[model samples]
Target: MSDLNPRETVQDALYRAARDLEARGVGYAMRDARRLMTHALGIASDRLTLFLREPLPAEAAGVFTAFCERRAAREPVSRIVEGRLFFGRWFKVTPEVLDPRPETEVLIDQALRFQFGSFLDIGTGSGCIAVTLLAERARANAFVTDISERALKIAEENALAHSVSERARFATSDWFSDVVGQFDLIVSNPPYIRPSEMETLEPEVLKGDPHIALTDFVDGLTGYRQIAAHAEKHLVPGGRVLVEIGPDEAQEVVQLFTDAGLTNCTVYQDFDRRDRVVEAFSTKPSKIG
Candidate 1:
């Protein structure tokens, strides 16, 4: 990085960082540069614009330079900053857990539509889903399970940070193997990328995210299969199951839920209008043979 000019303004630094990122083919370069600047300066994103004309502080300039370099290398801004904003709240993010995403908030909206005192979040990476639910619905509690102990720890920390730890229980479980009892609702944003599709993901995802949280290795349906096989048994009568899915997987996932005797299976789309979440109800056992 070029030495920061003592007289350089925040706007000047931002423009330089954005230009560097753009030259490296990063999409939304200015937006990303601005977010990084806010993070580096420890300022609220909304407050950043007000400081744009002020001289860039030496320390913050150094941090911004490092962040821009990481972005140029195809690192996601979330990974660079080690946090993500989801459902209007900030969650700590690391390579250990899947980065919390805006699309997952679609699942959150679908979930809150139903009345549930408790919910079970399977494959609770980063605890965003469970913690957000508890925070949104004051009386709701949750049991969140993850196969990775490290991921569980991250989730636990999020729950604590959100002041929902007392209302949330954590478990290291493969699907429902270690889970006990039923919940008023069940949810998961499981690894759905097929192995064949893994190579096509953005470099930021492939290089910065843990592969275990991105793909099922064999087929993307593995997690859905496990959920279908056991979800009905883990849901209370009239309870609902909501899981985010690859846009193309809606039909197959709905079929799996139907075959499991989970009725009222329906697909909900994200802001992009892509099929993103499959919701089903556990009213009674009546599978189509």
Candidate 2:
């Protein structure tokens, strides 16, 4: 309402919003402002530069300012935009699910490196992992499970949006409780943050994200332990399990897999050189007593 169209162009509004966001200590302020302006005004950021003398409608300016406020309060851009791009596909995201981070792509890359016919994504959240696998390997069968019904719904919508719904299945379960049969590949990006460390995470993560999907009540390895313990049963012989873990959790997770009798346990680093993923495979078929 502050004369957002005072002979200034959309580019001027963007720069002002970026300055406001920067003043509030929002990371990626310039980038987020540009994206918000593009989304609200329906114009590309590059195009805005060419129309610097064009004025933004009052309504558009109002919406853009509100977006800047939310972002300044540490709300994730994904939540504000209601979607994010993962593996070159747009995925619907919400407060109910953790925003899909680039680090998780390491899991997908690892999965594609192996020969597998079927895959399971435990704690699927927005179904980014499952849908990506299905879309990339058209013949692959994939299933995703989430404890939160709301999260599952978002995942389903994403699967359908990405045109992988037919090849993807959604279920509500606490880990593998309702999963049936064995899969050749099982992957997860489960809650791996320790309770004590949760307080230290960025405000956008600590306040805006769902805590249940970010941390486990115990030592932060609870999900990994459960997955490793039961993976041998839910996975075909020689089937591998891939998981994204906290940077400090790599060694502990590798030990858990080893203790569960999974062989060839290994950890991979992400772009930031953090130990970000763990991979292991079942040694032999074992009957559950």
Best-fitting candidate, scored by TM-score: 1
Q: Model 2, range 264-283, lDDT digits (tens) per residue?
A: 99899999999999999897
Q: Model 2 reaches what TM-score against the true structure?
A: 0.95
Give RMSD (Å) of candidate 1 vs. truth.
2.4
List pairs with backbone clashes in candidate 2: none
Worst 10 residues of 1 by lDDT: 280-289
Q: Which number leads on lDDT?
A: 1
| Reference-based lDDT, each prediction | 0.91, 0.87
> What shift in Å separates residue 199 of candidate 1 from its native position after superposition?
0.6
**Residue 271 of model 1, lDDT score:** 90
Q: Compute each candidate's TM-score over C-alphas.
A: 0.97, 0.95
**What is the TM-score (0 to 1) of candidate 1?**
0.97
Over 4 Å off, model 2: 1-3, 43-53, 286-289
